[model samples]
Target: MTQPYVVRYVGGPLDGRVDSLPATPEVPRQVVTYVHLHAGPKIVHIYELSYAVEYGCEYVLRVEDE
Candidate 1:
C-alpha cells in the first residue's frame, strides 16, 4: 500500500488542523494530481511541504517558512 498524504492548515484560524483523504488500493500510484479550493472561508499564509514518495519508503518532513 502507498502511504497517504494529509493536508493540515498550519497557520491562520485553521492552524494545527488536519484534513484527511481516503486511501484506496485501486488508485494509480503513477499519476499527478490537482487540488481545488471550495467556496467557503478564505485562507492566509501558505504552507510548504518538504515531503515526497519515491520507491517503497515513506517520509514526512516539516519545515515551516516564516
Candidate 2:
C-alpha cells in the first residue's frame, strides 16, 4: 500500500485547505476547476508543487493571464 501524505494549498480560494493523498509519482502541477455560480463559466486554478516540509508537501498557486 502507498503511504498517504498531507498536501497544503498555499493560495487561491482553496488556501489553507489540507488534503491527505496517497504518495505517488510527483507531478509538476495540480489543477483545480470550479464555477462561481450555476450559470457562471468554469475557472481553472493551476498550482505548482513548490516544496516539501517535515510532514509532507505544499502546492503554491500559479498566477497567469488567461
Candidate 3:
C-alpha cells in the first residue's frame, strides 16, 4: 500500500488549502470538475499539479481566457 501525502493548492477558490489524499499509482497532472455553488450558477475550476523547490508539490488553478 502507498502512503498518503499532503498536497497544497494555490489559486482559484481553493487557494491556500492543504489536503491529505490517498496515494495513487500515478498522480494526475490536473484535477478537474471542482464545483463551486454560490448565489448564481455553479462554477467549475481545474487545478494543475506543479513541483518546485520552494513550493514543493502543489496544485495551481488554471487561468481561463476572458
Sort every candidate by lDDT, greatest first: 3, 2, 1
Candidate 2 segments exceeding 4 Å error = 1-3, 22-37, 52-55
CA shift at 2, candidate 2, in angstroms? 8.6
Q: Please write out the lDDT profile of model 2 over residues 1-66, one tens digit for every residue.
A: 778777788788778888876675566345544334446676777777766665467777888879
Q: lDDT of all predictions, in order shown? A: 0.41, 0.69, 0.77
Using TM-score as the measure, the top candidate is 3
Tens-digit lDDT track for model 3 on 1-66? 877766788888898898776874274556644799899998999988887577567888889899
Indicate which candidate wins on lDDT.
3
Order by TM-score, highest first: 3, 2, 1
TM-score of 2: 0.61
Q: Compare candidates 1 and 2 on TM-score and give the better one.
A: 2
Weakest 10 consecutive residues of candidate 2 by summed lDDT: 28-37
Could you tell me which 10 consecutive residues in candidate 3 have the lowest summed lDDT? 24-33
lDDT of 1 at 54: 37
- Cα lDDT for residue 11, model 3? 85
